[model samples]
Target: MTSAQNIVVFEHDKHYFTEEQKRLKLDEVLENYYGDYSPFFKLIRNGVKFNQYVGVLKVGNTTIEVLPKADGNDKDTWRQLLIDMIKTVWGFEIKVSSSADLKLKSNSILDLYFELYTKELEYLLHRGLIKRYNKKEGNLYALKGALQFSKHLSQNLVHHERFYVKYSNYDVNHKIHCILYKALKLINKTNNKPDLNSRIGALLLNFPEMGDIKITESTFDNIVYDRKNHHYEKALQIARLLLLNYYPDVSQGRNNVLALMFDMNRLWEQFVYVVLKRELRVTDFKVKSQVSKEFWRSEAGTKSRMKPDIVLESRNNTIVLDTKWKNLYDNGPSSEDLRQMYAYHHYYKATKTALIYPGEEGKMIKGKYSPIEGNANASDNTCGIAFISTHTDIVIWKKNIISFIKENFFHVIEEG
Candidate 1:
């Protein structure tokens, strides 16, 4: 009997050509040798031999064969064709090996062939025959491996972290290292600041699945310990999430200017949700999607249609708030954003209108305005407008927002 292993190897080695090349070679062979055999004959023919074997000359290996073209009838025909083609073209000598007997029957040669090819490709990638372009450059700078030319398969299984650890020591780039360091920091935040050893192990163990690449625990651990990997952008995103979730308070007040910006936006929303529920005595507060139609309309349409981020309504008073992510302390509202907010107040018929922005260093704005009180109409005064700025630090911003709402809107609700 023919052993399954030998059959698989034979099939794999046969169809070594890529899909495009295989198609071209088969077309040429059919036109030249078999004269494009009749559909019936084409279907039945097992495999064709290529006129020339380019790989064999370069590699100096014999036993490569290019099988005749198949009409797609039997499965074995395709496998046999590939094996024959590889032998003829690449000239790699291959001897069929069997455990029990030299000649046994197998169920499906195509399946066996695919299995063998998967294993081979995986081995090549792991052995660095197919490697990342440069660990420091991340995915942007990847180059094709030698084997890549032979097989035009994409290196989708490659991850930035894996590439860094594998090739970091060979060449060190400072900028790339900083990125990798930040990425590790974010991952650590995700894992509750576990030791470096533990974090590295987790990353390796989480290898994305590919054709047949198996990740062992030890392999993962070794990659982590290797210490050369660096990827910055990925680290920054992860760190951002960690800062938002784990240490919201610390992130809000961090000396890092960007950190302040991020914290302010998050806390501003949170405070709005809390105050609307607690002070306004309303429980139905919800996070509105930023992609509302009103938000995207042209300036004129948006001024007429935009919904405020927060809407609080009672028997006598209705309050609408538009949250601004910009620095409100240093720079006041753009005429455009403020005008839009005013429109929301008017259109919604709300008694109170506020444009909220991130407060700057030692500056906070809390006051009411009425276009009617000046030369504007009394209707505009009925819709009081205010500009409120809250600190960028998450904890402080949250407190300031709540306090501002209480002093402004809550008092009105009580007085009424």
Candidate 2:
């Protein structure tokens, strides 16, 4: 298989291509995707502009990886940050090495997942593939196990040498192996990294060839694990991500696409929630993400709910927070965002509401919501903006965020 051409860009960055044909090829993929779902990019005059979604998109042999960039950081920094965030949010245990022998420089997010899957496979192979007793039905040269008399008689009457039997065979050729093997084929075709390809080839050689099984949502749900075979959990999780997201272009060869993208906004929200939940685990204050309350209902029972990105509740007080992935330099929060915060404060009965964003420095901007009747008195309901420096070391980033939250919303957290 031909190697893919890797291209890297930051979120909201416009990539202009010199080749007209290449741009057209990507356009075709984007057009088809937009028809069925939301388009990830907009077609410009010469190229495309990526939106807030960041991850890998492979169109034909060209792979485009969009990395999240904030506070004027380089691609590698953001790439690593994105990987860490994904690991925390998705609950994936990924091992990334910077050793001289490996020389994995500036690897894309997809490569990280690909490496994870391969590593899981290697571990399983080392432990030996698990064998499961499968009920198999086929023709055998001799009578074995239970004979399928109906099938044996219909086909074997002319050919007396053949005996059809239904037997239980204990082997690796089962659902788990089938899923892993299928994912191996997909990675071999989709991955462009030279180091990973050789590993995949070696794995396929050692792995038993199993017949293809049609995969569906229930395919994974039907799987059961015991102490003996529970190690397959990690590999199957990666397989689910790869196999379920694989899209083939039957009309054109080598034009298939695999998109492993995540919405930056939702990702930021989840990252904040996960990190806060980690930081506040020992504290009395409880951190929850997307806490919903019914807002409106129609006569037919159609209802709309309001969900705040993060909510910190203590025994006596509640603090509501919303996270924005983008920068808010000199501009203030949008009226819409402020309005949403107002609703969260009012509905949640929160003592405070704040918007958390990634920033170059720790800063706070405090504002108050107007009274319901627009009276002269100032409203007690307040919304503040807290900026956590993204340039800080990733090790201390979580603590820095938690500290900033506690300092800004000191009453609700520290005093409550």
Candidate 3:
């Protein structure tokens, strides 16, 4: 629709609004719909007639439709790029789905997830391998059990990778089956999708049902991925990811939308850390994430901490860098970010410090990644530091990060 009322905006593109109607809607998202996504919308500046940034922002009832960045041969969609970063950076922030299956009918993240989840389960079904894990439980209803108690415990006895028996609460397949059940319940409560809900609900019953499983770190701690346990792990992960996206029933409200949103800030940090690990692949250089520097000691002991996003340490030198997902514009980084970076340099005795942000070429003054940009807050007032950028291109962006480290910090020495 070419009508002003029906206009849709996409992530990472500029939208110039000549009408006050659209600006009001953008502000509504900023004020009202800003749930856990406050930081993301902050990246979208509400200018006089233009609001622009990366990522989707829903206005009223519709999710902002992102304009295609390229036409032909650039089939790498935004979701693919997003998933690529997620896989490389966190490695565990995904479920099973092919590239074709990841494309969305709508701009909504929730819609995309439901599609992926549905497809993944379907794939598992077609392969005939969406099996459950066998776990033993006690029962007295069936006298043929593992062990019968002194008569009070009727259901506290049973045993193996058993099948076709009564639902075992301890079984992982049963646990995962229950997770899907619980997620389906949550999804039903929302007005997000009705037909899809019906489809998922009907399909869910096809699998075995069990009592709700309390998912915890310990729930999966003992699990080891092997040939036998692979299917269960994949399904369990899908269930776990879905389970994490909702709040407890007590916290739910009338206006709050049950949407699953991931923080891109942490994603960017992890992405940089992963890429830098590649650049510093030499034997001498060691790259660590969240390397803590304890600068304060009290009765509590080592309470104050300086944990930068990345720490690159050689035998002689240490360099610290922090990743900011924000677009710094002409103003560069905030003073608070600089202050933290300065503290890192002071406490860790870091030879270099950098505030790395998402890069759009020609947007800001490109500075050398080297330490030649003298730190204003240096202990000696002479150490080197600079602001760096991580490009948006998937292939080149990673290489850019790797090269940025190699060219700026890594020192080569010739042996005798």
Candidate 4:
């Protein structure tokens, strides 16, 4: 087996391979994964171009980390930035010790998540695995709950010492454990780090073995959570993320792929919304994300809706904000984005609307909409192009964003 290779590519960047690198067949594996699962990357002539989606992908022995870079930061900085953004946006709490080896040696975003899952499982194992009552059908020496007459007659006819019985066996084998076990097995297959693999192996050994299960979209649909098993919530969430995104090569089992990707556009929008909501928590104004309003309806009762990324509403005014994750260095907003803001102003009755993007210093532009052709009155609504610098720490960036919003929309809170 060849040694594992770790490659890092920035967002929207293309990577062409050397002759030695081409033999890894990562392109073929990515193409297969794209066909079978998500089309996150575009396959060019001997290379792959990552789009707005940024995350980690593992194909056999190679780990590719696609990171988003808005400013002139290195891949490692952007990698940590992406991790921090995801942890903040998705509410993932990494509970490992400060000096843990996994924390020190996590090179990829996937490794961070894997380490989180492992630590979560470690905590659960320390607390003690919970036992649940499960319906099991097996050949038991003594009849317990119910007896299957047809199967018992056919099977027990030859061996009179056993009985085919169906009973409630209260043990550690349950759906939650099954999902965790499946995730552990997947990690064991996908991970190559020795330290993390050792922890995963220990977790697998300590955790009770569970029956193999076919995980589908509806696998966790019916899960009920309460105080008794409330601790498993975090572990199960990470497990779901691991188990669902994995696409196994059923044909040869050689190119098993696991992709953990998130759209940068959606992530940027959510990050802005969450930060705004958190900043405005103690204020009179309330922040909402994807505030939808039906703009059109068809004859067949089909409806079309318009959603603005962030909406700040008080008793008097509303401000709509749309976040774009691209850099707009000395450039103007697109006509499509401007039209979308115009629609938001008309529909949401927003007094002010703006398009937010990652930018250099002093890149804010302000403009007003012209009145209708025949109308004598000019519209009072206004739109803005605001940019937040990403070269600083996230905490400073968040504070600057909130300051810019409150300063520009000061009238809303003042009037309230």
Candidate 5:
């Protein structure tokens, strides 16, 4: 794929994973990713549909493959899938080139990510350079530093506050710096450094040294980015999201698979959110992705959180929809799936809720199910079903989902 060394690219269709690759085992994958006892394991164990995007899997102790799941010469199909999945899964946008020369090994997803992340990080370091006066503290009794003036006197038995003023390293700029630093370090650990590696290497001197602020989701929260200092928000978001590609506690010398892997379930949930958001009409309904906070079973100290993939809210009603990137064969929807949708429906106080799964076939399929059937008492058509094929175009897929909503869902609110 594109003459790139140490990189393998494949389509997002027709799993070509060898028998040995299929048998590849990772204890952390099942535990941290697919849940310790998740029913989704049926697919992972079978080597069927594990994740949504064309991704990487740790085949051996050191081998990693850039997987493209959508098979065929249709690079557009796979590229569109990657774009859609990335936007939804990671809250960032990537500028894509549809030209013939697929600059970062057209098929290598990881390489493309590195190229995009490095480019944006470099730009921000150059154009969005903002620094503010900051105060630093240390335990020096010398008069050389800005003296604390007897402050923290008894607390500083061995250490007094030696304050100094300089540029603040705790700003968002430093957050971007650390993300790039850690990402570069991980790339070297996983495989040979690609062409983009050198580009990132060049930008090292421009960024401030972030001492020990660990990068996590909270790093981007409540961050102020207005007209004055808003120039680098895009780069900061890209850098932060790229750093998340790795599993948090990936072992130093173990297989890099865990390090470069993303959860398919999580990816599909977000992918569906992106597609639906684009297709829906903003005037009638506002759509939100990963709607766990608006409704929950318990919100106290007990630690129980329920997050649905997409929530569509309108003046008429609020509908909660869950997306499952599973192949719903003859078995149809499972009981656990039904129970989850029921909870969303009850808590949201909405008459309409749904379970959406990839049809996994040639054509689109839709079903309206009262999953909790036979219990006539609860059989008010509270839950519906939808199936969108992986191959459908955005325009057509949106129409299908919206039509499903109109035909099956809107009636509930209208009648009430």
Candidate 6:
């Protein structure tokens, strides 16, 4: 017997309300007319029943009912529905408002829903309903439906040798589609419970197949064919499957050797970047090799060029940072890596030179000679040569980098 109403009030008046006021009003309406945020259904003595669907909201005498076209139980379905609503409301509001309208209200209802969804998902993942598996270590965890999609894709890549042979002449798109189709079939047969590592292996196996496949008319046709008729959706679907389902748990103290190698370089680079940006006020920094080619020469020989992972340049200082993914405490810097970074520092005339490596070891400024016992000998100190070690984890590395930059680079700048 409850009816929904659409009431269009003066946009100016609604826009005038503060965020706090709007929130208070929304809470009041929900408490009085609509059921609170909970999953339940209740029947009253009168012909009125309270539905615990969080999508429904009430304001004054009007009830805003968002009808979800897809299965609400499916997480993806709910996500897509919320996204569609947000886009619709945003487009409508933009179209209705004049260019002169300064007080246009932007709603965070969709963001709130997403936040709630994320919290629940995180809880589920932590509680072990949805588990993460490592592709490199060959760890298999049971996940059903879309959660297992990535695992299946990976397995198809590694196990299917004939897939490469079959799609030899096909374009990249076609080859990828062929692999995806095979993988999906394999996954579907298992009723969603499949080995995550095997799926990742499958995807990797197909990469070599598509390496030589040209992107041409055949490729476009293949994409259309696969998207419209095949079991899998898109190339990104394959990627998502790997990222979501088979994301190797790197938190186990780098137990997976492959994961350590895979994540180390990326984490090291990010750490150096964060540090340089925060400390030196050097926002314009780039990664890997390409600087002013005209100004620099290769350090290895007459032919081989040396490339630093991070290059930060400001008006006052130029910093050349070389990030080694290896654990400095264990491996230390090889003569080749040190030579490469030294070449970069010397060639670039970088005011500061950092050989950044992965570990929790403290900063080591180049003394008269090497100080860490059997550690690699320090080449010089005037160029501000330093060895900075940080944790391998991306989050910890980021924090360390920022702190290092603030203390070293920023302090120097401020002092100067």
Per-candidate local distance difference test: 0.37, 0.81, 0.53, 0.81, 0.55, 0.38
Indicate the residue-level lDDT of 49 in model 2. 88
Q: Estimate each model's TM-score.
A: 0.32, 0.87, 0.61, 0.92, 0.63, 0.35
Ranking by TM-score: 4, 2, 5, 3, 6, 1
lDDT of 2 at 170: 88
Q: Per-residue lDDT tens digits of candidate 1, residues 320-400?
A: 777654434345667786666666655666676676654332233444444554565644533333444433233454456
Model 6 C-alpha lDDT per residue in residues 87-189, reported as the tens digit of each score? 3322322322123332212222322322222222223223332112212222234232223445456665665431211111222244543343343332222
Output the TM-score of candidate 2.
0.87
Give one clash count per candidate, in the order shown.
38, 0, 9, 0, 10, 17
Instruction: Give me candidate 5's TM-score against the actual structure.
Output: 0.63
**Candidate 3 collision pairs:** 10-65, 10-66, 137-158, 138-155, 138-156, 138-157, 138-158, 139-157, 140-154
lDDT tens per residue, model 2, 252-361: 66678788888998998998888788766545668887789998999999999999998888888898989998877679899999989988876998889889888878
Candidate 3 global TM-score: 0.61
What is residue 140's positional error in candidate 4, in angstroms? 2.3
Error of 3 at 90 (Å): 3.7
Per-residue accuracy of model 5 over 1-416 as CA lDDT, tens digit each: 11222324442332334544434444443344445443322234443343333455432242334343433335546555665466445544434311222255444455556665666666666565665434566544444445554554644655534432222233444444555566555554443446655666566555555555676677777466776556566656655655554554355434333335455666667666765676656556678887665443455645567777788787778888887766566787889988788777677765678787765433434444454556665655466667654553644645665665566656655554
Residue-by-residue lDDT tens digits, candidate 4, 269-336: 98888878777754557888887899999999999999888988887878899999987665778889
Which pairs in model 5 have colliding backbones? Answer: 10-68, 11-68, 11-69, 11-70, 12-68, 12-69, 12-70, 13-69, 13-70, 13-71
On lDDT, the stronger of 2 and 5 is 2
Q: lDDT tens digits, residues 1-416, model 3?
A: 11223233433445454446454444443345554354333424542121233333333333443322322223235555665675565443344333353555554445655665666665565565435546554433453434434432333335322222233333336544566666555555442555576667666766455577676655656566777547556556655665654434233243233334455666678888887775556766788999877778798664876788888887777778787776554686676876676677668877777777665431223232224356533334222334454334577867777766666566521120
State, as a TM-score between 0 and 1, how close model 4 is to the true structure: 0.92
Q: Which wins on lDDT, candidate 1 or candidate 2?
A: 2
Candidate 5 deviates by what RMSD?
A: 7.4
Predicted structure with the largest TM-score when compared to the true one: 4
